[model samples]
Target: MRVHVVGTGLIGTSLGLALTRHGDEVTLEDAIPTHAALARDLGAGRLPTAGEEPDPELVVVAAPPDVVARCVLGALVRFPEAAVTDVASVKGTVLAAVRAAGGDTTRYCGSHPMAGRERSGAVAGRHDLFDGRAWVLTPTPDTRPEVTARVAEVARATGAAVREVPPDVHDRAVAAVSHVPQLAASLVAARLEDLDEDAVALAGQGLRDVTRIAASDPHLWTQILAGNARAVRAVLTGLADDLTAVVAALAALEAGDDAPGARGTIARTIAAGNAGQARIPGKHGGASTVYETVRVLVPDEPGQLGRLFADVGEIGANIEEFHLDHGLGQDFGVAEVDVVPAAAAALAEGLAGRGWRIHG
Candidate 1:
C-alpha cells in the first residue's frame, strides 16, 4: 500500500515506520517541513508537500484533536481516491466537524489507539507503540464501510486489536479509563511539589507508580482536555462523588468509628481494586494474562539473563513478561519475572532448587 501520513509526531512516525517495515511505501507530511524531513531521515517516510498530489491508498491524520478534522477532510478532498483515518482521541466532535466543513465524511474514519507514553514528537516514536493496544474506530452513516475497514487493517498491521464503537461511546470510555487517570496522576504529583525533605523522603513505588503519567506533556494534554471537555467533565463529576465518599470514610476512621466495620469495607474495596487491576490486558497483544512477579538478583555479566530465560523454557512453561532495574554500583540487578499464577509456585521452586537468587 502507498500510504501518506500527516502530522509526523509520535503516533504518525511509528505508523509510518511499521508500514515501511511491511514493504509499503509511506510518505510523511507535516505542517512544519522540518519534522516531516526529520521523520524521513529517521526511516519513517518521505516528505510530501501540502499542495502536492497524494497517491495514497491510506492517509493517516495524526494531528491534535482541534486540527484532526481539518486534516482528515483536507486529505479526503485532495486525495479523493484515498481512504482516510484520523488518530484523534476525541471522536464525535471531529466527525461532526468534518460534516460541518462540508467534507466527504464517507472517505474518512475516526480512530483512537489506546496506547502512548508521556512523550511526543517524531523522535519519541517506537515501532512497538501500538503492539497489544486497543484501537477503536468510529464510523457514521455517511462513512464507507470499506474505508473504516481500511483503518482496522492498518491497526492490525501494527499488532493492535481493533474494535468498532460509536463515537460517543469511545469518548466516554476513554474519559473514564484514560483521561481521568492522567488527571488523577497529575493531581497526586502536584500535592508533593511543595513538600520538604521530611515528607519527600517517605516516597516509595506506590507514589511513583501513581504519578508516572504526570510527566506527560501538559501543553498537549491541555489541548486534548479542552477538546474533550464534555466527556472529561462527566468523568470528573463521577470522580468527585467518589472523592466525597472517600473523604467521609477517612473522617470516620479518624473519629474511631468502628474500626472493625471500616476495615472490612476498606479490605473489600482493596480486593475489588486488585480484581479490576488484574483484568488489564498483558503486554504485546496477549490476553488478560495475570502474572505473579518473582524478582531474582542476576549478575551484570552477559548471558546471565539469557540462562535464566533458557531455564524458564526448559520448564516447558511460558514467561509472560519481565522487568529489569539496575542498582547503582552493584554487580547485580533485580529481574522481576512475571509468569502465570498457576506456574508461579512451581517455577519459584524450580529456580530456588537450581540455586538462582530469587526474591519474593
Candidate 2:
C-alpha cells in the first residue's frame, strides 16, 4: 500500500516507519519542511516531489488536534480515491469539525492509537510504538464499511489491536483513561517544582512512576484538553469530588485518630483505589494475576541487570514485572522480580543455585 502521512510528528513518523518496515511504500509530509526532511533522513519515508502524483492508497493525517480536522479534510479532498484517517487523540471533536466543514465523510475515518511516550517529534518515533497497543476506529454513519476495514489494515500492520467504537464513546473512554491520568500526573509533579532541593532529593520510584507523564508536551496537551473539554471536564469533576472528600477525611483524622467515621472514610477511599488498580488489564490484555516478588541483590555494575534477566530466562520463569530500587549512595541495589506465585519459588531456587544472592 502507498501511504501518504501528513505531519511527520511522533505518531505520523512512527506509523510511516512501521509501514515501511512491513514492506509498504510510505510518503512523508509536514507543515514544516525541515521536519519532513528530517523524518525522511531518519528513513521514516520519502518526501513527495513537486507535481508528483498524490495517488496514495491511504492518507493518514497526524497533525495536532487543533489542525487535525483541517488536515484530514485536505487529505480527503486532495486524494479523493484514497481512504483517509486521522491519528488524533480526540475523535468526536475532529469528526464533528470535518462534518461541519462539509468534507467527504465516505472516505474519512477517525482513529487513535492508544500508544505514545512523553516525548514528541520525529526523533522520538519508534517503529514498535503501536505494538501490542489498542488502536480505536471511530467510523460514522457516512463512513463506508469497506473503508473502515481498510483503515483497520493500516493499524494491524503496525501490530496494534483494532477496535471499532463510536466517536462519542471513544472521547469519553479516553477522557477517563488517558486525559485524566495525564492531568493528575502533572498536578502531582507540579508540587515538586517549588520544593526544597533536600526534600526533592529523597524522592523514590513512587514519585517517578506517578509523574512520568507530566513531562509530556504542554502545547500538544493544551490542544487535546481544549478539543475534548466537555469529556475531560467530566472526568476532572469526578476526580475533584473524590480528592475533596479525601482531604476532609485526612484533616478530621489528624485532629483525632478516633474521629468518628473519619478513619473509615480514609480506609474506604484507599480500598476503592485498590479495587480500581486491580481491574486494570495486564500482559496480553488479560486479567491481572497476583504475582509474588523475588528480591535479589545485584551489584551496580555493567551487565549485572542483563545477567539477572538471562538467569531468570534460564529458569523458564516469566517475569510479569520488575522494579529496581536504588538507595542513595548504595553500590548494591535490590531488584524485585514479580512472577506468578507458582513460579516465584522456582525462580528464587534457580538463582540461588547459580550463586546469586537472593534477599527474599
Best by TM-score: 2
Q: Against the unseen true structure, what C-alpha lDDT does each candidate score?
A: 0.85, 0.92
Tens digit of per-residue lDDT, candidate 1, span 240-300:
8756666667778999967556665566667867987877766764568667887888899
Quote the lDDT for 283 in model 2: 75
| Runs in model 1 lying further than 4 Å from the true structure | 48-52, 255-275, 283-290, 295-307, 324-335
* Per-residue accuracy of model 2 over 163-192 as CA lDDT, tens digit each: 999999999988988899999999999999
Against the true structure, candidate 2 reaches a TM-score of 0.93
TM-score (all chains, Cα) for each model:
0.84, 0.93
After aligning candidate 2 to the native by TM-score, how far in Å is the CA of 241 from where it should be? Answer: 0.8
lDDT for residue 148 in candidate 2, whole number 0-100: 94
